[model samples]
Target: MKLTTKGRYAVTAMLDLALHHKGEPVSLAEISERQDISLSYLEQLFAKLRKAGLVVSMRGPGGGYQLCSDPKEIAIADIIAAVDEHVDATRCGGLGDCQDNRRCLTHDLWTDLSNQIRVFLSGITLADMTERADVRQTAARQVKRLEMVADSAR
Candidate 1:
């Protein structure tokens, strides 16, 4: 499936929030800095996430965004879908119209592949991803790099 930057970045930002939000909200700027995503873009994504009931926002100083539910309850597929992304591998987008208004020879094959991918992603959650050794290591590195950048600027 062709997951776009929107899907990838939404997952990355959510994972960052799950990793860092220890009973507190995490700012979009923090996710933007750690994931190398633009703040404006993050704002857009977070808006959609909030509307989807996956996240909530706060105002005033010391305020930011927090997960609306447990990370384990938030599936990767849900995040992708919240951002209006599809996990289709078919050239016809599963509409069976790949060739001149008709189903192509491999339409079923691609459709089945898309279903498998959706199911695979649906089984994985932000909490599950946060428990990975590699995810922890990568988050640590991103935090260290951000710290170094802040120090250099001072």
Candidate 2:
């Protein structure tokens, strides 16, 4: 399945939050700054995430957002689903309408593929990703680049 930017960004932003999470919430603005996502887009995604009960918002000074449960409890599939992303690899969105509004010859194959992709994503959690040295290194490098860009912009 080809994940669109919305799904990709939601996962990336969630990972950023999980990685930086401490005793307090992680703001979307901070995530945007570090991950290079637009503040408005993050806001939209977080709204859906909050509704999905994947995250909780803290309202006050030093408030932003925090995972409603532990990182291990949050699956990558959950993140994608919370943002209304469908991982259908089928051309007809698994509706069997790929061939002139009828079932295509390979509709079942594509549907099975989409299901497998979902299963794979569901098996992965944000905490699992955080344990990867490469994930941390890439995030650090990205943040450093953002800092340099900000410095140059000033």
Candidate 3:
């Protein structure tokens, strides 16, 4: 499924906050600068996230935004849904409904794939993402080591 810029930026902004703030309040400027997203765009995305209770904002100097819940509790699906993102790989909302008597033969397959994608996204939390990052790093290191060994043998 293709994620729009809004959804991608929102997640990156949120992850920046989670990694840097560590439960402390961080200003929008910091997140924007670090994530390379425009301050104005962050403000817009954060408004939706705040209204959805995924994040909270504070006013005044040294005040900006903070997550309403632990990062571990937030899922990618939550952020996507908060941004009103749809993951329909196929346009047309997966063919017309059966009751409309125009159901596409592949409708069920698309529907099932959509459901699986949703479930997979919801099942993973931001904390799970962090773990995945660690796993990626480990794999990279292993690959580097193997490459070095191959170079030595050459």
lDDT of each: 0.95, 0.93, 0.78
- Give per-residue CA lDDT, model 1, range 1-154, as digits (tens): 6899999999999999999999988999889899999999999999999999999998988788999999999999999999999999999888888999999999999999999999999999999999999999999999999999999999
Give candidate 2's error at residue 152 in angstroms: 6.6
Q: Which stretches of candidate 3 lie over 4 Å from their true place?
A: 94-101, 134-154
Model 3 has an lDDT value of: 0.78
Judged by whole-model lDDT over C-alpha atoms, candidate 2 comes out at: 0.93
- Error at 3, model 2, angstroms: 1.1
Using all chains and alpha carbons, the TM-scores for the candidates as numbered come to 0.98, 0.92, 0.78
- Per-residue alpha-carbon lDDT of model 2 for 1-154, expressed as tens digits? 6899999999999999998878799989999989878999999999999999999999989999999999999999999999999999999887788988999898999999998999999999999999999999998898789889899999
lDDT of 1 at 23: 95
For model 1, what is the error of residue 7's alpha carbon versus the real structure, in angstroms, after optimal superposition?
0.5
lDDT of 2 at 32: 90
Each candidate: RMSD: 0.7, 1.7, 8.4
Q: In terms of lDDT, which candidate is stronger, 1 or 3? A: 1
Pairs in steric clash, model 2: none
Q: How close is candidate 1 to the true structure, as a TM-score?
A: 0.98
